[model samples]
Target: MKLSSLQAIPRCFHTTRWSLVRQATADDSAEALDAMETLCEAYWYPLYAFIRRSGYSPEDAEDLTQGFFARMLDRDILTTADPGRGKLRTFLLTCLRRFLAHETERRMAQKRGAGLIVSMDTTWAENRYLHEPVDHLTPDRLYQRRWALTVLEHTLRLLKDEYEDKGKGVLFEHLRPYLGLGVEPEQSYEAMAAKLGQSLTNTKTQVFRLRQRWRELLFEQVSMTLDDPSSEEIKAELSELMQCL
Candidate 1:
């Protein structure tokens, strides 16, 4: 669907998120450079995971990932991204695949960490990679799962920050496990109420409100990636991402 059709949809919450993508496509103004940096920081891990799964050594993968971002920014490749074509993740993955196929030799020959574009925590990334299942899923499948997980992690972090800002950090900690379906909470509602100095009914209500806000935030997060932020498109993307989990 075209983004113009969704013009009437309220976009106050999504403007900042989508602006990063839109701005990154512009000439090298400060805002555009900052936007592209933020996108790379948030999304570099999934692409790295894809590369590692594709059989490159950790050292080579790191070099390739850094080189890809460096080339992408220096060469103005992001100017080619057309939101109307599809989601941003798809565009990035396609570019990364093409880079791997064509640029491996040249990138590997370069000095490690030469022209680093994004600051990635290599230790954290490698540790995370070590924990992934040893199943025979293809690299593409691993990338999809990693992308879905990254979105969920980002959304939860946002929610936690909001709660902390309101001085409800402890409440959020207790209620977090209940945010996911089928994940049993360690404490009963009655016990939680007593600990928080609230009635059992109030505790239940808080849980309900938390879950509701999570859904709202999740929807907004998914909407930020779409060219057409229509309700139907958002729902379809959310469904597909959830299935990847």
Candidate 2:
């Protein structure tokens, strides 16, 4: 998704760097495991995509992805994550590169589906990979693009849940497209007002509010991936991610 429309969103602040990493690496408690699992679920596919771009077959990529996570969890590799180094996106990709270099032979020798640590929807992952545009993106570039999309997807999910909780689930579905640029003329505010049974003015107002909330949520989501980023740093990161799209 192009993020030009979201450029106006204000910066958001949050204390703590690599809170999720810290939580995931803190101990072997259930909470820590849950944190680690959440990270895995959010990012597994991007790593998978990277592996595929690096020339692994889908089956091999699936096995390697699973093995990488298994090794990460089993050996408590996250304990080595340093917030001062950079974002989690960079950290994971670096670790994955190292794993592939040293552990590929050992991991590939194991039976398929052995030592599964984190559950993933490999079927869905492969389908998504199949649909990707055949572009000139290198493995690293594709990883960054996928990572940006992942963040946007998570932000949209949060927005959807918020609207659903307020009994405006259907309205959210209609307004969602307006949160981004390039909505067709046929899907104009007047049409939305008619469908929503509200004044056109009110429909426009709702769209504005939706876009604002989306910006706020997107900012918060991006902020979480950094290590106590300044406002300028967050904006720069967002800009780079937007370029990836």
Candidate 3:
């Protein structure tokens, strides 16, 4: 659902996310995968960046992060997500962080550790994760990265629903290259234009619009998470939350 859609839904309670479990189970795998794809687009980068700052080399970070997602899918973690206990974001981050910490030493510097692993374009992941300023990164910086990623993920979902409703799903997919994953210059403008069946100039304009809409949606999502809240309070809470990452 888009943030606009979410806005229309009554803000009955912040602690009501458990209601989502019923909706999720009612849908099939395609629906589930779509939800997950939305999540991956939003989150993969922040987590990758976190791992990098945590001291993994680029390749190892990419591998570990990709492996993390593989486990998420294989184990059907989303299916088991218990939202009634807390916000979905906290639930996801808590699980992922613990899982990685538990397995980090065992995984070591290995190539494709034993398990059901999806072969991501780890090279692509590496390139995308490199955009962050790597100089003198600290734990606090990594938390900030995590917070930024959560905002982007929420934004990406809202954008996806908006585009889908407009029959612009193709545009969302094409323009996504520029937004979430960072721009791939090797992915020629012409290539993206062809994918969306729009002129390169139009593609550029649409992307800007998409980003603006997403920014508003992100602020909205963060606001929803607030209880004893002000925008500044929410931002402070967010900052503190990321530090634990």
Candidate 4:
């Protein structure tokens, strides 16, 4: 998902960092486990993409990412995460950077470990990373792009789940393309309305609502990735997200 394709959102929302971090630090409680798992599930792809771009083979990258998360979770490292230092994403990257500096040697000295921090479909991840554009983008650049894509994807999943819960899954499927830049050029409200047995005016209204919901969801997702997302900070992050696309 490119920045240009995302719907523009003009609302300001606030989120604080360290909610999960605080939970994770408290003897690794169930809440902490859930929070850590949620984060790992949402972010492993970007981390994996960064490792791959750093020249690790797919297998090695997978191992390193798993090991990194394992260490993070097991050690409750997030408790030490200082929001004052930087954004959460940057902190993760810094951790990965430090990990990569010695991971090769450490892995070679010991057998591959068991139990990934969270179970990931390694095959699915490799397939996705394999198709990433072959360009001059640095590892950091690729990670940022993948991060933005992941945030957008997470928003879509949440939105889709909401639609499914309301028994509007079919409506969501029908209207999804209109919410992005990848809409079929030939597809139009007239055609969509006809296909869905609705009037053109109704179809247009639905699309508008869908886009608005999408923007809200997008902002919500992005806000979670920061410390305290101020109005200007959110705008800047949104702009950076667009540029990543």
Candidate 3, 33-63: lDDT as tens digits: 4545555655666666777777778767767
Top-lDDT candidate index: 2
Any residue pairs clashing in model 1, and if so which?
A: none
Each model's TM-score, in the order given?
0.87, 0.87, 0.49, 0.86
TM-score attained by model 4: 0.86
Taking all chains together, the TM-score of candidate 2 against the true structure is 0.87
- CA lDDT of 189 in candidate 1? 85
For model 1, residues 1-245, the per-residue Cα lDDT tens digits are 12222223334454544456555656557776676777788789989999999998898889888988887776767668786765878888988988888874553556997768899888899999989999977889999999888888888999999999999999898898776533565678888899889899999999888876777777787877766577777767777887887
| Clash list (residue pairs), candidate 4 | 2-245, 3-242, 3-245
- lDDT, candidates in the order shown: 0.78, 0.80, 0.59, 0.77
Q: Higher-TM-score candidate among 1 and 4?
A: 1
Model 2's alpha-carbon lDDT is 0.80
After superposition on all CA atoms, what RMSD does each candidate show versus the true structure? Answer: 4.8, 2.7, 9.4, 3.0
> Which tens-of-lDDT digit does each residue in 1-245 have in candidate 4?
34454456555554343355545667457765676677788889999999989988988887888888877766767778786654678889998898898775665443454765778788999999889888978999999999888887878888889899999999988888876644455378899999999899999998888877887787777666677665556667878887887
- Where is the poorest 10-residue window by lDDT in model 3? 1-10
lDDT for position 145 in model 1 = 91
lDDT of 3 at 58: 76
Clashes of 2: 0
**Model 2 C-alpha lDDT per residue in residues 1-245, reported as the tens digit of each score:** 44556665554475433565566656557765666677788889999999999999999899889988877776777778886865878889998999999864564667888767778788989999999998979999999999988988888899999999999999888888886633543388888899999999999999888888888887777776777776666777888888888
